[model samples]
Target: MAGPDLTLDQARQQANLAFTASGTEFAFGDAAALPLPIAQMKALSAGSPGVETLHDGGLTAEVLCLKHAGRRWAVKRARPVCRVRNIEGQTSFLNELQRHAELAGLRLPGVIRPVYGSLRDGLVVSPWISGRHPGVLDERQARTLLETGCALIEHGFFEWDYSAGNLLDDGERIWLYDFGYCYRFDPLTQFNSAGHGCEHPRHHLAERIEGRHLFGALLDAGNDDEALPHFIRFKRLAAQAYVDLADRLARRGATPPVLGHYRGLAARWHQELAHAPGLLYLASAWQAHSSDLDDDLRGRSCTPRTLQRAQWLQATLGAQGHRLRRSGALSPDDAALDDTALLRRYHDREVEARRCQL
Candidate 1:
């Protein structure tokens, strides 16, 4: 009566099949009617008068702002050799192009659409988005990001990286312009595009946002009093969003664990929001910082935040490790480590982070 459930890798292959078959190059709409002439757009050098090099953008690509015919467009040229030196980094541009096609077809909100791209040419062109990466998010920005993330999940796209560079805020809504790390999975039966999909149940939309953005933003808050309020607000929003997400998935015939995962998170967050919000904040912050720190280390693309996260982990283990243990914040492997060992590990990581600074 129905097709068999697919593994995460299978799902990804199916999703990108057409793109692969079509030689992995794509251009949306009539190229003849494109906003900028593709030849001229590609030919323009970084030092050209009207071309502005935004930043190195690190590892995968370089972006330039092109002022053509009075309109600004962002021209992203993939590096001949990706700096991150991993399979994911090497293939990120093609993955992004695939996601752009999928998202454009879905007409998903809060995502900036690219006008043209070619994998072979190592180029992607989209209208320049006028926005800033805000260190701290207000309610509107936070809610918008949550909604966009939920939409991606509900539609089977798992966005792994929500780093500051991937998001932009135009004073009203947050825009997701980077899909380099986003992948597809069977949302009806899988948690994410990792470890056979459902094996890593702890990874989810809220977890990603916290690990990649929220906790980093909270790092700026001078004290618990300043940060607690923001965490509380985010927890409240995320809990409700999960509940709503669970309901939508249930209607789509999602599996029990998938349903329970969101429901459990919502219930726990709600309970904590009422009684032990501080514990919730502490446990989540510890987990977030630690997870992101590991990601940076594994990628060998550490940033200043990686050092900060490592220091936070060291300080937390030294000061509140017992509480972390009680709160079940430590991973099973981490739980085995004594406070001294944990502190030493993080201290070493901090040094490694300094060496790998991007």
Candidate 2:
């Protein structure tokens, strides 16, 4: 007789088999009893009543609904490809969930409450907060939301993937979701302020804001001229917040990867400021292309050549627009002066100059 077709149990068994073959442990659980409390789920769902597909972005499966217990939540399941063929991809996802759990209570989205399976066949659940996109908010509202989101990250010592889609606004409040890639920073590299990697990822930001109708609406609201300046200032403040938190982490002797990551980040911010000065004010020109900063800043793969070009652009733009100042104090000839200080200074000078000009 041929082998029996796999039922849910059989499928789960297969999943376990696959995980074991891949040198990982696979433990099964009662699906009905999730790690998170049913009460917490009900409170989060606010009586939404049933599971509904919120997003099917192809990479992951997402279901939004109120559990039978009356709590709102989001359940995320990796695609079969991730489970079977791309185990490493699943490992990243699992790592993300673990990080989220560790970083809970930082006013960030809740943790990935593991449910019903080992790492290979698990479901991750988090609270569902209803909100609109930042691009949809009015100028004042958008700025406030962005500031709040950044502030949350600052306090949490967590770096969020700031792509537009991960941010949501629900009329009165803005919410950030999708914490699978979040990580803690080392205080030393993070606090140095002159280290690298402080710059926001432009490509991710661009992807978030592009094609959002609300972005166009914001641009058309007679405030297109101010958006770029607002965003630049926002980014600077956010970077500083990260630096401060990272410094704290460093003092505690955080992990090497975490320290290195923030160091790289601080450096990036400095480099961007020294090089791509035009990008600082690009948001103001949004109306001309009907594209918001988030959309326009995507996929900015930088290299030595691109860095040189950005620096040239900065010099060229500095002749017309205001200049950015270096932030923290440094020796006049410190070769160790990484790009971070220069960028912070540049941001400070530019913002101050713009304020005066306005």
Candidate 3:
């Protein structure tokens, strides 16, 4: 059967109206009335046996835990008014459901299976992932998680919301949940000249570092000093990766948005490295606590001090070129300074250091 036909905005309005009309406090019960097949409703109830009324968190939407077909699932409904400017989350969630349904049997978590209705006020039911939110893992665990995450990203499983709270660790293994904002990262198709095709670069970088640092802190048992270095290295590596990806896109004649994101990230990293040298050093020192040192050490061995210096040099080169571009006074010699070359050198040096240390 075809799914509900409604724009995210329409869905949001319908959800809000349903919430108000039902007077059920939580919109879950009311949302259920948004026209679903009787059989599907019965199946949902059967799947989530113990669900009845659920809690409501006042945000863009209301979420409810329900029992359908003897299984428990989360039902999220959008509000009536479009308070949030970007409908990315709503769109991404709908996309995940569609994509995951097509690629069933993958190890990844289930999407909004049986989508039962439309994007707005829709009922998405996936098995609840069990375990506490993932934090920094010990050296062994961190390596495992990082490799796993990288592999996932490479496979086009880019979860825009990779926060610690979104990850659940069941002691034996880690399962990613809350994939409402996940997207397929297509290097070729998903680039523009203004910025990357995905979310803002700063938001992406901040979320990535926050997740990595949380992992680092967990590995160090909440010792900020010990986790500092890992945070620095993770940030640098992430920024480098972003810049490299942007360069590749630029070479393909991608839009300025794509290049802009990379440039922004590179500039940010350079600024941080120059002004907050101590922070980077502290982050590197904390790398000792990463569970993934073996993977890091498998490449070049970079001292905290060296990484900082290299980052500063690269940033300076980039800033000079940017200034020239803005002022329309870029000399051939100044333009000759290869930003990509400097970035590669820093990347290789850091990888080598990490490998050696491991």
Q: Which model scores highest in TM-score?
A: 1
Model 1, TM vs. native: 0.92
Per-residue lDDT of model 3, residues 1-358, tens digit only: 2235553334544554454456533211233433345345334432354556553533344445665465555554444543334454324444544444433435433222333324444444445544666555444334444544544443445555454545566675565545555555554444211133444333343345353345434343544456556556655655666666567666777667656766686776667676874444443332322212222343233235334433433453454434324432233443454667545654565556544431
Best by lDDT: 1
Q: Taking the tens digit of each residue's C-alpha lDDT, what string does model 2 give over 1-358? A: 1144533223433553465568774343344666355444333332344655456552443445444456555666555455223332445455455455554434443222333333545455555565555653545555544455434434433433444566666665556556544444323333211113234322222223332333343344445345545544544543554465457666776656655555565566556656763454342232222222212233222223223223323343344332222322122442254455544544444333333321
Sort every candidate by TM-score, greatest first: 1, 2, 3
TM-score of 2: 0.46
Could you tell me the C-alpha RMSD of candidate 3 in Å? 15.1
TM-score of each: 0.92, 0.46, 0.44
- Candidates in order: C-alpha RMSD to true structure: 3.1, 14.0, 15.1
Q: Write the per-residue lDDT of candidate 1 for residues 181-258, one digit (tens) a residue.
A: 899888999999986887898899999998999899888876666998998998899999999999999999999999
Query: Considering lDDT, where higher is better, how would the candidates rank from best to worst?
Result: 1, 3, 2
- Candidate 1 Cα deviation (angstroms), residue 273: 1.1
Spell out the clash pairs found in candidate 1: none
